[model samples]
Target: MATIAIVYHSGYGHTAKVAEHVRSGLEAAGAQAKLYTVDAFVDAETGPWDELAAADGIIFGSPTYMGSTSAAMAKFLELTSKAWFTDGWKDKIAAGFTTSGSLAGDKNETLQRFATLASQHAMIWVNFGAKPGYSMSNSDFATVLNRAGHFLGLATQSLNDLPPEQAPDAADLQTAEVFGQRVAEATKRWVRGAA
Candidate 1:
């Protein structure tokens, strides 16, 4: 079975909710997916570094803050220096997800950071294949597809004013679920082909 590690930092639990939806898709796709919070790892308490190292694929996630990734995600990325130097994640499959307040809160920048980091590690980047959902026109009601229309990675939107528990919305989380399933299937194909 393929193993996927979800390393993320959710400042207000919105991202965490998205992560679970991703896990649902991953599990449905037949891969075992695990979640690792960057904060937990920071305290030297939780997180399975070994699982991360052994994972067939890794999905990086974080909230977009100040037109970039969150500080916690930044710190987590910084901690990967040892792995980067050793090419620990070389050739592994990598994807990214991000949550932001505005419909377009420069969340693409956050996804770009993840892709850049994957490139530096010599990892393969997975692109989001969904089209933009519900444009400026509310009558469109385009929500089943990629809501943000990000081709590089998954970009989810959450209302900043609402509670984190109810903000990501069903549509945003469903988009994430599709992204997760896509990655899982891709990983399975790559693994089986290599075998």
Candidate 2:
């Protein structure tokens, strides 16, 4: 079975909720999934570096802040430079997801940050494979997947006033689950191919 690690920084719990749904999907797909908080990796010498290195895949998650990943997430990415130097994550499958206060929250930039980081470490970056969910006139706005139409990775929206429990809604959560499954399946194939 594939082992995937979800590394994230959820400032207000919205991203954390998305991570949980993603984990559910990964588990459903027969992959072992674990969630790790950015706070635990603030110090390079500390945290579960070994666990991350052992993971077959890693999905990065963070709340979009100022049109990019959160500061905490950025710090974590920066700290990965040590790993980059040693090619610790080379050939591993990598993916990303983000939550924002607005629908078009420049979330792509955050995903780009993740992809670029993965590229720097010689990892394969996975895109959100599902087509846009609200492309048709008859499409239901409330129940469609990939409603925001982001291709680079999963992007979800939440109202600033509403709490995490209610803002992301069922559609976005379900979308995240699907995304997780896709990544897990892809990782499994990639691992088999490598073997």
Candidate 3:
């Protein structure tokens, strides 16, 4: 069985919710999956980097802050420089997701940044393959092409003062799950072809 690692940082649990859905999707697809929160890496005796290096696929998530990823996630990426030097993630399937507080939040930028980092490590990138809803669909609230990125893109409407727990509705969670399943399926294909 292939292994998939979901690594992310959640400022107020919104991104964490997305990460959980992603993890569920991967597990449901028959892969050995694990969720690693950036918070744990700060002081944990052993971080998830080892697992990440060994996994066949990796998914990254982070909350958008000031048009980018959380500082914690950024730091995590910076730390991966060591792994990059050693080509630890070469040939892995990589994807990214992000959540922001508003429609105009720079969530896409965050995902793009992660995708670029993945490319730097010579990894294959995956994008959300779900068909886009018509512009009139209530779920299609964001602007056209709003979700564009190397991999699955998700947005939540967190109106002022509303927390992510109450902001991202069922639709957002469902999208995340599908994204995860797609990645797992793609990873399986890659592994089979490699063998």
Candidate 4:
């Protein structure tokens, strides 16, 4: 089975919730999924480097802050320079996801940041693959997936005032599942092809 590592930083729990759903999707698709907070890899000398290195794919997640990735995620990205120097993650499948308060919260930029990180590490970046779920006037927000219309990766929205439990709704979580399944399947294929 393909092993995927979901490395994420959730400031208020919403992103973590999404990551869990993503994990479920990965497992459903017959892949082994592991979740790791950015803190796990922040300390270079004592990090879970072996676990990540063994992963066939990696999915990055973070709460969008100031129209980009959070400060914590940025720091984590910088720390990955060690892996970059060693080509540790080369040829692995990589993808990303993010959440924000607004429906159109410049979230694509954050995914772009992640894809760039994957590119730097020579990883194969995977797009979200799901089409926009709210493209038509008849579509209902409550039932639609990929509501934010982002193709780079999973983009979810939550109200700033609402707690994580109430925001990011069922639809966004379901979309996250789709994202996870796609990545897992892609990783499986890539791994087999490489073998």
Candidate 5:
């Protein structure tokens, strides 16, 4: 079975919701999924490197702040420099998801940062891979699974001041769930091929 690690930093808890949906999807797809909060790792003793090294895929998530990933996520990335040198994450499937306050919060920048990080580690990046559920002219964002129609990665827009428990909406969360499942399926195939 393929194992995926969902690592994220959620400032206002919005990103955490998204990460959980991804985990659900992974588990539903029969792949083992582990959740690792960056802040938790920093505050406690989490041997994240060992988990990451054993994972067949890694899904990174964070909330967009100042048009980029929060400093917390950035710090986590920086801490992985040792893994970079050792290529500990090399060949692992990688994907990213991000939540922002605005519909278009330059969230792509954050996803691109994820892609770049994955590339530097010689890992393969996976796209969101779901068909768009609505057109631009549609007014019901709630009906579309991928409301933002993101192609590179999953992008979710949550209200700026609202609590995450009420923000991601059913559609965005469902999209994340599907995105997670896709990554798991891809990782399963990748691992089988590697073996």
Candidate 6:
């Protein structure tokens, strides 16, 4: 079976919710999904390096802090240079997701940065395929990328101080689920073709 590892950092549990939705979607798509918090590796005591190395796909997630991923998640990305140098993740499928406080808080930039890191590792990228869900009345909350994004991007919004439970909303989770399934389905096709 294919395995997809979701590695992320959620400062206030918002990103974590998105990760879980993605994981659930992957599982539904017939792949084993594993969730790894950045703290699991950054804590200096508990790390899941081997688990990460064995995955068929990797999805990175984090809250958008100051227009980028959290410092902790960034550090985790930095530490993956060893794997990159060895080309350990060269052919794996990669995707990214981010949650932010505002409607236009540079969330796309954060997702793009994550995608760049994945590209540097020589991995294939996937993106959310949903159209922007905008209405004339609520254009501010509307997104061009919708729940699914473009080129392996997933964007979510959590209004100020409202927990992820309220921000990402059901629509965001639904989008995440679709993204997960798409990634897993693509990975399966690639693996079968390779064989």
Q: Pick the candidate with the highest TM-score.
A: 2
Reference-based TM-score of each model: 0.92, 0.98, 0.87, 0.97, 0.94, 0.89
For candidate 3, the TM-score is 0.87
lDDT of 4 by residue, 1-195 (tens): 899999999999989999999999899899999999998875766789889989999999999999999999999999888899999999999999999999999998999999999999999999989788776584898889998999999999988998988989999999999989999999999999999
Candidate number with the higher TM-score (4 or 5): 4
Return the lDDT, model 1, position 148.
72
Error of 4 at 144 (Å): 0.6
Show pairs that collide, candidate 5.
none
| Tens digits of lDDT, candidate 1, 1-195 | 988999999988999988998898899899999998897565332456667889999999999999999999998888887688889899889999998998889998999999999999999899887767655665343355676778899888888898877878878888888999999999999889889
lDDT of 3 by residue, 76-162 (tens): 888888788889899999998888777657677887898899999999988887655434554454433323232345544455576
Over 4 Å off in model 1, which ranges?
43-47, 134-139
Candidate 2 lDDT (Cα, 0 to 1): 0.93
Misplaced by over 4 Å in model 4 are none
Instruction: Give model 5 RMSD, 1 decimal.
Output: 1.9
Clashes (N, CA, C under 3 Å) per candidate: 0, 0, 1, 0, 0, 3
**C-alpha RMSD in Å of predicted model 6 compared with the true structure:** 2.9
Instruction: Give the winner by TM-score: 1 or 4.
Output: 4
Q: What is the lDDT of residue 37 in candidate 1?
A: 89
Best by lDDT: 2
Off by over 4 Å in 6: 43-46, 135-152
- lDDT digits (tens) for residues 42-69 of candidate 5: 6323556787888899999999999999
Alpha carbon deviation, residue 103, candidate 4 (Å): 0.5
**lDDT per model vs. reference:** 0.86, 0.93, 0.77, 0.93, 0.89, 0.82
Q: In model 4, what lDDT does residue 95 have?
A: 95
Model 2, residue 25: distance off in Å is 0.8
After TM-score superposition, what is the CA distance of residue 167 in candidate 4 from its true location, in Å?
A: 1.7
